[model samples]
Target: MTVGPKARRSGLPARDRRVTTRRVREDQRERSVRADVPTGGGDVGVATDAEAARVQEREALRLAHRVVDLAEDRKASDIVLLAVAGMTTLTDYFVICSGGSERQLGAIAEGISEGLKQDGYLPIGREGSPDAHWLLLDFGAVIVHVMAWPERDYYGLEKLWSEAPLLLRIQ
Candidate 1:
């Protein structure tokens, strides 16, 4: 029946009346609740660790597809996209493509890099030279291999990582 500040002071035990650390924490938790916060179930604002990882994986897959499209634009031949997340810890996706000649290889590499950079993606590292006839552009989650027909056939990356699923191929 009594419910004012003075009435609230009338308590049973000293232990119940005093504001302990645990009691203060409980009071803060109660006060922090708002319409935006869930009272019981469901999460809000931030994603869980597993969900975040899956989101990152989806981003990597998207990037891989973008690379494929860019390579196709530049007339790359024998394009193959491989999902290597389960097979390798190095990268999530592998984009293997072949060009007719060394000059074509460089164009494929440049086209992929410039196109991705425009969309806010950059290569972490680049490997091989024009003379080598093999170019590798590493973009963190996704890696691109630009090779001449002979080298691509010689290495046989698709055969090497045979366990990985082939997401796409344009021959």
Candidate 2:
């Protein structure tokens, strides 16, 4: 039953009906714009350079910690995490660990790769080789070094980047 304003004024009985009005005004969609560049002038959603850098730092640290955890799961020895963000522009963190042997080095590298992949992250590049007694997994924000005992001692990464803050170390 319908009861429109005009229907009651006409002294007519209400009738069952269904009606939908047309969009006579011709609706138009608003144009899209970047939030960082506000047209009306507002301070919302605009991050300063320092704020953006801090966010990046947090993400890099998280990735580094996860890599260290994965290496531990693979029984990697002498695991050391270095914060090289201030020292270099190459990567934010460096996770160096000893795998004891060439086979173990491969395992450690594979474990970190597999673990991070589950979280939707994959190494941007890989360098060296398992047979070479070392492997490098480049995850952009984090760089992992899976090295054999001899290689790790010879490379002396800790000595090379001694200035970089040692964030974590697990013997």
Candidate 3:
């Protein structure tokens, strides 16, 4: 088969040429859309989503540590801080701790919630009952899990997120 000079030079069939042109146009359109969207950095012109996410993750980890401190102060046991930012998109950090009893678990949860609240941060949602074996506090970028010793042992959150790096652990 004989090919024309232009077709031979371009090295693509007519159908492929059309598809390539369309793909280029689509890419241009996507770049335009991304150009208009503001990065979450607040007043810093433009940044990649990954950059913004890193900033958020740092802040979330800081808050997670604070929660750990509060729980420890309240005498929560076996506190663990997991850096889940690289493992999951759910939250940047998971502050998991065990309390000896339901009452102690409730006290730990309340201490963390109120302590962060005093810092002008409020949980987005709270689940599990304070009277139950497990209490979860969701703070958008961070999640706190206060569980009874038996619940913590049964759930094994640390094992579940075993791949996540352990940022802090207090026995």
Candidate 4:
């Protein structure tokens, strides 16, 4: 039988020919494996678009809850979670809560930042002033608003996002 140039030059015996063929087949098999499979490098499981959206929604909801819990822990009141996944492209969830005073608002924001930091999450942007009536923390998938009662009432976020479903409310 005719062997390839490398094999012919190596002058390998018949026994070695069988080993080389097996090695070549193994290499081909490895190369042909699907790319979707996770390679244990922190990649989540492969999913279709719909599945990916659902996963993101689930994660957003979890983050929203975490924000609510942190705010509540800091004595924030009138906590509300709005699921704006389908209604708005800006963010998946909106976590709205009220702080009694400017000091409380700062405390609430700090609590949220420290809490989310434990999960390796940092806000992409923070708007409004901690000393002001409203402070917003944007975490990409979730946006948290720590507002004073008057500001929340005047801004009417609930009215603006009325079409969005209310996922959770903590009085």
Candidate 5:
């Protein structure tokens, strides 16, 4: 005599026959792994976009200080950091400073450029010269402008980039 399917299964008892919730979850997890489901950053466990941004910003702040230190070392007359609303694509912060004369301005600009380089940031562009009244350094996330006192007064960049956040002001 052959035992029926239900009768044979019932011999094991209902409690033993049921699958545990933990086992079901494990099966689903295994299936997900086999399917190559997205876990955001894959196996290496890298930072997400927001975390990366925070790190970038922190680095930028460090660079900014380095630039300031270089300027101070080179004897720049005044240093200002502006968070202009819309001036350039790179930095949320703008560093503007002045020197006693055209020659001083050029030296200050050069020093800031070098300092930024030490921090692993390079200026995309620069303008003006020692003979001219002003010099500009355009790092991707921070822009530094060095100008002679007279030129700074005449151009009034602070007024031009009026919408900026105004992080620092020094005369």
Candidate 6:
């Protein structure tokens, strides 16, 4: 049994209800639906869903760092991360790091290659060799390049793709 305003009109309560109805109507009239609707959470600038995604990418980079640390820890030298923006913007980031010797470079490349594979990342392709002074591991979202120090300098990947976003740098 709903109480109609006519049935219970003491005066104050009915007026209050009318005021609330009017305010709601006014709000609806003023509000416009946005084209870019937010998904899953708050606004991106305000520590919401987008920020959380960036944090996740950072964590992924940290996992990549384990590969870097493994290289450094194994006596390899000079870790470099490069971001390569894809031709169609499909691939957003890249990582290029290097080691000391050809053997160590191979080890570093193998570590990154295996590590990324175990983490469920399939490389598009990989090239070069530890003995060849450079090794490339191509994960779709990011690429890992392991090179000897001199070869890294000679190619200068850092300068080549300098405009891409640098997500992490482990010296």
TM-score, cand. 1 = 0.74
**Candidate with the larger TM-score of 5 and 6:** 5
Could you give candidate 5's per-residue lDDT for residues 72-123 as a string of tens digits? 8898867887765266655657788888877788788878877767765556
Best candidate, TM-score = 1
Candidate 6 residue lDDT tens string, 1-171:
112556255445665666665565444322222223344655433344555556545654665565566556555555655444433243435556767677777777776667667865555557877788877765544556777788888988778777766656767
The order by descending lDDT is 4, 1, 3, 2, 5, 6
Greater-lDDT candidate between 1 and 2:
1
Residue-level lDDT for 18 in candidate 6:
65
Query: What lDDT does each candidate get?
Result: 0.79, 0.77, 0.78, 0.80, 0.67, 0.59
When superposed on Cα atoms, how far off is each prediction in RMSD? 20.0, 21.0, 17.0, 19.0, 24.6, 21.9
- Candidate 1 segments exceeding 4 Å error: 1-44
- Worst 10-residue stretch by lDDT in candidate 2? 22-31
Residues 55-155 of candidate 4 have per-residue lDDT tens digits of 55666678889898898999999999998878876777999999888999999999999999998776766788867889998887789999999989999
What would you estimate as the lDDT of candidate 6? 0.59
Q: Write the per-residue lDDT of candidate 2 for residues 1-171, one digit (tens) a residue.
A: 224775465465444222211121111000112114322356556545655555556667888999999999999999999999888877879999987677888899999999999987767668888999989998877899988878888989999999999999999
- With a 3 Å backbone cut-off (N, CA, C), the pairs that clash in candidate 3 are none
Report backbone clashes per prediction: 0, 0, 0, 0, 3, 3
Candidate 4 clash pair list? none
In model 2, what is the error at residue 14, expressed in angstroms? 78
Lowest lDDT 10-residue stretch of candidate 4: 28-37
